[model samples]
Target: MARSLRYFSPRRECPFITIDLGSIPESLFESELFGYEKGAFTDARKAKAGRMEVASGGTLFWMK
Candidate 1:
């Protein structure tokens, strides 16, 4: 079975950090989850930190 990722806060402390993934674009797959290099793809002009990197200090819930 497969599951769509949902970020859940155990304590429900910060309601402001909500992410409605329904509006997320498909193009953000690798570039978001996995780190990407500068010019990794055609549209990549700068090295941007991916979500995995951003979630380093915290928890990352990967549905798949």
Candidate 2:
């Protein structure tokens, strides 16, 4: 379904990201979904874009 939606989207120029929740660890889910700043965490050497951020102006699909 997610793939279908992405393929049929009018904004084809934008991105479509899909994350399988079942494959991700519960402890790391938050950070992966909502990224942190460079200094937000002890090991955060650089800021990274989360699934939500990468999917901005596009589509985000989550499967559990």
Off by over 4 Å in 1: 1-19, 61-64
TM-score of 2: 0.84
lDDT of 1 at 52: 65
Best by TM-score: 2
Worst 10 residues of 2 by lDDT: 4-13
Tens-digit lDDT track of model 2 for 1-64: 7677667778567988889999999988999998888998789999988999999999888887
State the lDDT of candidate 1 residue by residue for 25-53, as single tens digits: 67776666666888888988888876667
**What lDDT does each candidate get?**
0.55, 0.86
Number of backbone clashes in candidate 1: 0
